[model samples]
Target: MRPTLTLIAASTLLLATACTTTPLPPQTIGQCNAEPASWAIGRAPDQNLIDDVLRDTGSRDVRVLEPGMAATMDYRADRVNIDVNDRGAITGIRCG
Candidate 1:
């Protein structure tokens, strides 16, 4: 009985853990006509040099999706595609 109870408890924990936030549905591709010469975002000046320019920009409320690229902040209904080049500098910005 004790072993059975332990097994049941473990099962319950597993069930609870399995319940997670569902993923968002797919969205249309965002527009990226040209690069943003110099747009004021919420990050510091040296942010681009340190890490992923998008991560530093702090542009949340994202509604669109950059399928291949990864996102770090909370996803929202207004995404801003922060495009960067090979050197980790912001090359473009598009809010959707």
Candidate 2:
């Protein structure tokens, strides 16, 4: 009888665990759409361009990455990353 109760408790616990829902990761929520802002590539990076990129890409924030600049590798779905060259021209745009 004791072994039967233990088996029932273990099965109940497993069932509860199986029914639990895991939250979506940050990268999966509010993802930035960079396609609209692809037109900004090859243009100069400026405050206006940054603002436009943010609006167009539906990103909550913007990060300008220049050559040799150190940046964190963290992935943010609501951010737009603008990569520029030494000539100060925008080279690439992406969402992480």
Candidate 3:
């Protein structure tokens, strides 16, 4: 009985040591700057314009928000959101 208990204790200790957690590597987070893309405001939103906005803002993604559209409240620094009015004209440009 003593040998069995010792073996079990040793196994538990070995398992615990093997389960150690390693620190994760640092990640590069993208930050969007809306100032450069401000030129897109009041302009129509198309694939070409959206691409330009992304390039100008240094954003990883773009979201076009039209009137009455439902959007998540989450803020992402790597995203650019363009708001359009009812007439399909771009109204505002922002970075989230």
- Scored by lDDT, the top model is 2
RMSD of each: 14.1, 5.0, 7.0
Local error of candidate 2 at residue 93 (angstroms): 0.4
Each prediction's whole-model lDDT (CA): 0.47, 0.92, 0.90
Model 3 per-residue lDDT at 93:
86
| Ten contiguous residues minimizing lDDT sum, candidate 2 | 23-32
lDDT of 3: 0.90
TM-score of each: 0.27, 0.69, 0.69
Q: For residues 1-96, write the lDDT of model 1, one tens digit per residue.
A: 999999999999999989977889886343222234135233332544323433334443322223357666653433555555555444545653
Q: Which ten residues in a row have the lowest lDDT in candidate 3?
A: 25-34
Q: What's the TM for model 1? A: 0.27
Give candidate 2's error at residue 84 in angstroms.
0.2
Model 2 Cα shift for residue 48 (angstroms): 0.6
Task: In candidate 3, list every pair of residues with a backbone clash.
Answer: 76-96
- What is the Å distance of residue 77 in model 2 from its true position? 0.6
Which order, best to worst by lDDT?
A: 2, 3, 1
Q: Please, what are the lDDT tens digits per residue for candidate 2 over residues 1-96?
A: 999999999999999999999997655445699999999999999899999999999888899999999999999888999999999999999997
